[model samples]
Target: MGRKLALLIATYAYEDEGLRQLTAPGHDAVALAEVLRDPDIAGFEVTILVNEPLHRVGAVLGEFFHDCRHDDLTLLYFTGHGLKDDEGRLHLATADTRRTNLAFTSLSAEQIDRAMSGCMSRQQVLILDCCYSGAFPAGWLAKGDADVHTLERFQGRGRTVLTASDATQYSFEGDHVSGSAARSVFTRHLVHGLREGTADLDDDGNITLDELYVYVHDKVVDEMPQQRPKRQDNVEGRIVIARNVNWAPPVHLGEEPTARASAPEQMPLLQVTPLSVPTPVPLVAGRMRWVFRTGGCVRSVPAVVDGVVYVGSDDGALYAIDATTGEERWRRMLNAEGVVRSTPIVNGAVVFTTADRSLYAVDARTGALRWERLLGSQTTLTVGIVGSLVYVGASNGVYAYNAEDGQERWRNVGQGMTSYQWMVLTERLVIVGNTGSHVYGLPQADSGKTWATRIPHRSVSGPSALSDDMSLLYVGNSRGELRCVGTSDGERLGEHGVTGKAIYSAPTYVSGSTESPGTIYVGNDDGHLYALEDFSYERKWRFVTGAPVRTSPAVDDATVYFGSDDGIVYGVDVTTGLERWRFSSGGPVRSSPTVMHGLVYVGSDDKGLYALQATY
Candidate 1:
């Protein structure tokens, strides 16, 4: 029933020569204050102190906690340099703090503990984003279990504490270069979750303290593997921290929004349109809807279902983002050993492969892991899901698992597969491209019964698409040979040669309805996207790009969209192969485009997931 209060302290301009000047504390404080003070969000009465002297900070810190009542919710956040004294006691450095005389010049953990102990608030939360901030409770009591004893330091009945790192680690500063905005890696995610409402893990319009800690913890570790954020809780009940501004009422895909929902932005962004290429009707790229930033490069192809877009990143986590706002909903850590380069497949569950040579199945709604299976060391390709079965190709062989339980159905060994082999799933067969200029079609009923077809070229590096009748399969090899093989048998029907050095982009086949001849769209390492006639393998037109077009093109009614290694996503006319519009990202884009509704979604190596919409 009482008001919410917050005291945010940041000290970066240290006077002592031994103390290192930090660039993120001031920026972190300002961002946190804005989110906490917003009436629609946290609605906290905030008192922020930036670069204050030790004496002034101590006085304000004491008075801030002293004014709280038993029913009030009090939050204390500090971002600065946390130092240790000769006795291994923790001290918070301030603007005028000296390293030589820490006991008198800096604020000690004991002093803050004393002020917190005297405060009447039972709902108290302490967040420390600093080097060695985890030593606060241990340094104060020097007693029992670290977590339990830390909770006892504060005299309040229910209190929670979150630190940027454990006692032995240092908090990291991120993107603090000459021209970029300075930000602490830990606090940056904190503000992002609160402001974007991503910390609302349940999507119930409320963000709790525990949810905030978990969101920040995963994001921090993904960016800085050396730093592990810590959280110790002794709260009796959930403490609601903020209201989710981005929360939208649950509306299933294809269903109209309820009266409570206002517009497209208030609804979950879900893709209903299928992805095709080289259709009769062409579409053009309009304006950029939004771009979502992650901690690392985003090379994983995104899967859109309902209103959430699921994608993996080099940051070692799978993120589910809202399609409309480009704000994250939830992120789950898959593996620490390797980055996620495989595109995610979302069925009833989400399936993806990490660089660690493992396949993971997680719940679609909450991102909770359902099951995981270890594969061959080279198993890192995107998985294919058909019905209740999931298929993948590894260096050793092809493997199949039950999509629901992750149970191994079969493994056909001795066939050589590569990381780039794009497994093409059909009604009766799982067609896979290999590294040795060979393609295999393993029968769905029996993976052991496989048919191999040899291409008179180098390795097959991309995916294969079926003809409109599903009787012919077309695959491209590293030697720039487009080979068409009969689906029933592995006999090569025909081949078309190109001038490109290689072709890593998967070929997409569009039927063009019953009126037009089928067209095939593919990209080449020679920096061009080619549109070819399906049966005759005749080149209709070729569109040139600045760099290699490594991404497969996604086609809708009027346009074919794809990304180039030059860091640009281009929309081209499907019929003429003429350029329509282009959007540039910060880094190279290897992720394929996904088109649905009136929007196009793709990822870039620049750590961005972009959503571009067509102007009506």
Candidate 2:
């Protein structure tokens, strides 16, 4: 491993009256330097310069990069005023920087780039937490009046740059005074992620450059939505930046204190079964109840139990919030690399899959790690829990594990099978649709393949929905076709074709008599949510949206709720297909809505978990 090195420069007090003094840079530099110098964490030989003049700062920057070996990992951080010349070139302002004489008094990006270009070290990182920090043009060539392109300024082999904001926004400092409020929003999150060991996104004990940037970006945006962090990367492979000082192997029951590395499967499996909880009263009308924000996009569908909402996010953590007040109860970071994108399955324990191909079972009440199991290289396709068994679908196969200890009981691999939706779990079988134009049903008692039904001219777009009596399965495919099959042997029952381009949304069936079969609601890429008669297979009503409705709808007593890519959540009457209420979120709404305790809980790409009023 190469030695780690860091150069931190913070300029706050300016000589020119035109440039206002900033209170956060000096504090930010000192705090970051301390964390970087820790031998157990970053282990970098850090040199910090506060309020330094242009000549001294420039000389040290050159020496810092030029003196490092090709194998060494070097990090450069700047927190101050990033001013642009009349020609739109970015310049880092120093203590003696003059507004009128910026080119001569301030450090130019060309000077820093030249030093970096001359360095032999291939592993280099630059972090800028300043205003207009992204205004550096490509190759130091001026793009007269063009938008700021920070990547263009530092795009090279083995180079990475992280900026606090894009060219159009200003970096934010919470307050102008020298106190706790003076912390720079961007730098504060960066330090917190590293120091607290949360930046180790994969939960693998090592913090990579990509993980750190994502963790920092999510936190910065969550705190300051107006500021969007940007990054430029040209590295060949993984670049480990630091070790997570606070990380430790998960401790399980029956494992001795010294046996921290024991495999999860080695522990005895317990019968941790889900409770038989009654459903809450459904809402008659909808209103905005409360909105809770997370560190990153909340694309994972939320699971509500016992007046609490459990959700996951790209920020790499599972969050539990109060259903009524929307206050955070607890959070557990799973894996930063693959983040919690799959919907969480909450029983006695909360089961979730990360993009990193790992499945974790945690305590539902307290968010404590119960057990973890590593899956195949392919990302987890879907996760489901029933009684003492947990079912997982991946690109490689379908697996069954003990819900309590994550012990694999059996696995059935099928060639070319891939799923992008949820797994439909029945009392006797686990049904799943695949993009390979096939559907598979596995016995719940074991991994025996029950049936394999194939579709023609289209692939299964999402998960299949079973009828209330569990006799029939309704599936939607990429060809805008809705196919019905018998759950017993996967026999084709009936089929209906829609004019929509593709059906990515899972089919949702409302309960009715066996003969009636209620209404089946599904969304497609054509921006319409189609309602069809279950037995007749005839279209009843269709509601249109501003964008594609890619998520499955959650039907309550009288209303159906779903989200759209247009950043809106809509509640339409179940029978009339007339809009009841709509809530606009900050970004796209991909997470499906869950109605519980008279509130509809949903996650948005804007990093918010919203609790909309549905009661009165």
Candidate 3:
């Protein structure tokens, strides 16, 4: 019988004071152990090493590799501190580590590579959840970020390496005392993609390294704009493992499978075809229409142009459907191993960045790939079209590309940058945010620094509505606090908290009474939809939903349409907070609803997409 194996090295908590500060407590080890112990993975041997005293990792690692058989699959994961020596060599810090005695306490990337070089099994994965791991000298680091030692010594064959950050960065720990030092932002999203099934883009049972990298890259950038992960691949050919396994789809409100329809009873049941009616005249009362459902989690805001709505899904596809009919006009498969978290930017004949870690110019009408340019190994945060340039943010940095050919124009790495999440484009500047709660303003001309401000809460999502005049910028944080910041000097206008729920979605703006000017609408994990009066920071009203509301809200005229985890899409009075109508779906409706042409478009976790009409 074939065996499966996982070896986890969590080297933070030990006698060595320096290493202890960097390693997470035992809980990190346990969490990883739990995943390795899953019934799905029971067939393989698992090994775990915590902070053992004195150069213990090498011997244990050697033993594990030596014992592995040809038919076994292996996963090697390490959670601790990583450093680069003076010579630019990557080293994994051991429990008894002392920076002064690198040779005695640290393990070099070359040593690990050499240890695994003789392994007969073709399916192996190496995950390093430590800072400075990108220094591993594999050809994975981009030109400027690569260290000379890594380029010369550590390259290996038939292996995939996933690192926490670039060579010069630090990996963080979550705030919780008992949790992993910092759920390597990359690992957290990788696990999410695996558990949610987005990593299996082709719907195959097993996930590929390519898919895993894309999933981790997109999710981490979406969740932690500050920390950009690095991926190194040096396989002679495509490495496929667990080829016959199927990944479960990520948990969404409407993802549940429905039973097949039953045949009509023998008593001559009449076939009822719903009558078609003439298209209703556009409501003169400034009412909005909610219509189509994507039946997947909606990550990006819907793009509406020329009566057609475009959006991306966790299902690895970009969908363009009729704004009124909810009928799919075309869906370009991203072929990514993860969900499309960023919204699609549509420009005439081209629609861009639904997924795949690249900026793709696709045929807007036919869903064909017109052109694709690999920007970096991170997810595209928020993309905007300004004249001839397409502005986008990825984990590695911010970039501007030619709107027509997707050519590189300019990129500005975030200053004091830990990670890059979302960016808002203003007339004179482009403002982007990081996980460290810092926001940077880059002048549009030379990408020169304008001004940088730090918000109170960490920004997990993108910035929204910097105002057409670029006066007030509205931003939300993971702590569920929404604030209006002055674009000029980054002065705090005011802030309001939506309970304690994290605001995972971007805030949307609606024109308030000419008196109020800017009213911000956003959703929270606390399952509430909120409307905040811009300047005064007063809570206009809040509507409670059945489940957590992580998707942003879409507003048109007087009504607001959004989806909730409760498996329902709601249409509510924007001013009164009254439910105008509610449509139940088969599963959760975590995706935001797009309102256009008398219809709302959203995707549920359920397998079927839906189109609903409001009956008065």
Return the top candidate by lDDT. 2
Q: Which segments of candidate 3 are over 4 A away from where they belong?
A: 1-298, 336-338, 514-517, 607-611
Candidate 2 residues 546-611, lDDT tens each? Answer: 577888899889888999876767788888787666655656788888888678888898899999
lDDT of 3 by residue, 69-188 (tens): 776567788776776765566777765566666666688777888878877766667877775533233443433434323333445665677766664556655543344343555666
Which tens-of-lDDT digit does each residue in 1-616 have in candidate 1?
A: 7778888887765556466556677668778887787876777877766555676688889999888899888999998888765556677888667766788989987898888889998888998888543333334544322222222343445688888875534566764423344677889899999999999898888888989999999988888887788777777889988878877789899999766653222222122221111111112223578989887888877888999999889988899999988888899985566588788898878899887889999899899999999886577376888888888877667788999898988877766554335677778888776667777778876656557888767655566678767788888877798888888888889888865578877788899666667899988887789999877878999986657888888998898999987676888878888767666565678999898778899999879989997433
lDDT score, candidate 3: 0.65
lDDT of each: 0.76, 0.77, 0.65
Q: Give the TM-score of candidate 3.
A: 0.51
Cα RMSD for candidates in order: 24.8, 24.4, 26.8
Stretch of 10 with least lDDT, candidate 3: 276-285
TM-score attained by model 2: 0.53
RMSD of 2: 24.4
Per-structure clash totals for the candidates: 7, 3, 35
TM-score of candidate 1 relative to the true fold: 0.53
